[model samples]
Target: MNQDNRYVICMKWGSKYPAEYVNRLYNMVKRHLTLDFQMVCLTDDTTGINPDIKCYPIPELNLPANLPERGWKKLTTFKPELYDLKGTALFLDIDIVIVDNIDCFFTYNAKHEDSVVIIRDWKKPWRMVGNSSVYRFKIGQNTYPKLLTYFEQNFEKIRQEVRHEQAFLSNYLREHHHLEYWDSSWCVSFKYHCLQKIPLAYFIPPKKPSGAKIIVFHGEINPPDAITGGGGKWYRHVLPSEWIKAAWQ
Candidate 1:
């Protein structure tokens, strides 16, 4: 693979995630990959990040500044003028762990001609597409303007229709045929792949998948809170301490 053609991309904003998470992800990628690749973080702050990472500012979206903080920020991935990136870029959430080599994610593509490739949620079988937790795309293609346009025209409709960006992407891509669901083994759900909770100590922790390349912390459970098992009242109190230790170390 050409060194210049690959990228590991992530985003961060607000106090929820620390800058070190981005740095740690860079370390994980470097430790696991044999090929030369750039690890880029599109963030609002650069302090505390490793020098190896190319930090870029999070692009402004069409949404209002006063809007409540939700997962909609992820939709910026589709903005053409914002990112202005190129080549095969793998988008990973800051809350995941890289257990196996993720170099293959860039190589895989849809059978048809499409710019975006993602994974289908196994639980929601009827849905044509899945969450965008881990996805690959060619920058500047502007393959996702329809999503932005939809939000622009039907903001209230969307607010009532779906709760997050993933839901919008799933529906929009399903209509356009630009969506491709990846193999289940490539990305596994944390709840399904690891333990939810321990009977005693409330601290037995979760287990990592045998050969899973990426374990995504979707929904309410994230890395920091997952480690402490202290997200909120509705969240499950499962800590994947062993998995986190093995993958990050």
Candidate 2:
């Protein structure tokens, strides 16, 4: 591995998000990151993805047939041999919008190279859960057999304890590694930080978050919804946000 190689990887296994999300992410990273890096996407379908971005098949988690899928596929990113990718990998969810310089994500903890860095969950701060929407870790490092083997053996027990993949991942890394977080302001949630309160939501268009490098659309309201003002719910009305149109592209 080249000492200078940095990687930004995103997952797009299902049809819930289109290829445009991957392309736009590449463009956003190209604009913001000063460092040289390879843009990679792991997807089930790569028909329309930009040729500049490398495409790899999403590794199989191989869960039981009766098991429910709650973002379990994302765990495969920790595969021991991830298509020859090594060194630091920053994983971004496809729906997230980059609005500022993101070079800090790779450089935040310069001394602690072994630490697993992630975004602190916006909703569950007290429990210290990490939202996997944005996280940086060394490829094929701590989590391969340590995280995967445990999950495979104790999937039943793990499922009973945590609802989703992020919770499972956060809990494991916290126990084993130096689980760090990006600055709270750098990875803001669009719905939490930008959307106005109920009645006011109708009057005001969604506001662009200040000091946010990546605006995360966690549960609802993705980039398209923000661009066209489709907040995806009846009560939450988002008037066409022009900044989203400009920024998401």
Candidate 3:
């Protein structure tokens, strides 16, 4: 496997996000990443996806039917030898907008052999957690087999214990002392960091934070909603911005 090559991976399953989400994400990534890389979309429907994007069926987790589907499928990314994807892999959620150069995400900790790198969850203040909107690891490396095996064995107990997949993975890494965080400024939350005060949000459309490579849309304010001011709630608001239109294009 060539170390120079970067593999960017993302998944799309249900109708919550359309094929356009994947297409927009690919364009944003191309505009931002200045590296030799291939973008892979693990998806169930590829009807409207671009021809250039490498599409593969979403890897099955084989979890019980009772288990919630929210973020459980992401666990498949940890499976050893996932689709034989090689080199450093950076996982980006389809909802994210690339705002700056992301060349460093692949090379930041190249010297460290087996560490899980992720964004510090902006919502969690008391305990350390990884947001997982953007994260990096070597494909097929199996950096934390014990954690993966444990989750598989104790699927029910782990699900009952943690709030979600990100929390469970965070606890696993934190316990093992192998979890590291990208600079807080690099991957920022749109709801919290971008638009803090409700009144101010009405006047000033969200701006790209300094040194931010990716702007994450964790909750209700997705890129489309942000652009059209269709944000769900009163507190969760955004002014229309031409920049978002260009970035999403």
Candidate 4:
């Protein structure tokens, strides 16, 4: 693939996340990537975003208007016709910190003809990949249709069996030989990499991994609230303030 044909993608909507988060990601990608690439934010609101970051309107999947809120809206990334970018693209959640160069993620080899490269969830059983906090894929491949079919055929079954898109994706790719595990150290779990409050909140942050490229904020805690440690909600309370501050700078 032409190295110039790469992109960094993220999705945004509603007020839960601020628009600056999207702009910050754009800055992170610009600082870390050495190749000719574009940073694309798929969003419903484009106001106040950095002008350099290209914005694509989020595509509407034809799911029922009253579909229960299962956080499955994120599955929209898998829509082929919706994303027309060529070659390989890396998708990052806006809540993450790009502490190191991400150019390598673009270069890692795929495991199979239809494989997607993602970090294996070490905390979960080896058979199950944890979350799609960060993943890379080729555009216009229609990966979403296969995913939708699984939900359609096993709608009730999946609702009872899985809580998130990652679980469904891991199962689908496992069956198709299209799931490749990224090197463990390349992507570190925030709970493990930062502070773990088992005994107390006194755990000092460890030295950043020598070659790790990304730090994912998967659940609850995120970069903004993590860096401040001031958000009152229970979900935002476990953040490692010092760690995120240093990582973003």
Index of the highest-lDDT prediction: 2
Error of 4 at 175 (Å): 1.6
Candidate 1 lDDT over residue span 1-249, tens digit each? 332477888999988888878887888888877876788888898989888888888877766568787678777767754454666678888888888987678767567655478877767768665777888876556556566777667877887888778888778776875778778888888766665543532656666767788888776767665565556333355653755766763
lDDT of 2 by residue, 119-195 (tens): 99888798999898999888854434567777877988888899999899988877876678888999988888888
lDDT of 3: 0.80
Deviation from native of the Cα of residue 38 in model 4, angstroms: 1.3
As for model 3, its CA RMSD to the true structure in angstroms is 1.8
Distance from true location, Cα of 129 in model 2, Å: 0.3
TM-score of each: 0.85, 0.94, 0.93, 0.85
Model 4 lDDT at residue 143: 54
RMSD (CA, Å), candidate 2 to true, equals: 1.6
Lowest lDDT 10-residue stretch of candidate 1: 231-240
Cα-based lDDT for every prediction: 0.73, 0.84, 0.80, 0.72
Q: Which residue pairs show backbone clashes in model 1?
A: none
Angstrom error at residue 191, model 4: 1.8
TM-score of decoy 3: 0.93
Stronger candidate by TM-score (2 vs 3): 2
Q: Cα miss at 181, model 2 (Å)?
A: 1.1
Q: Give residue 164's error in model 4 in angstroms.
A: 0.8
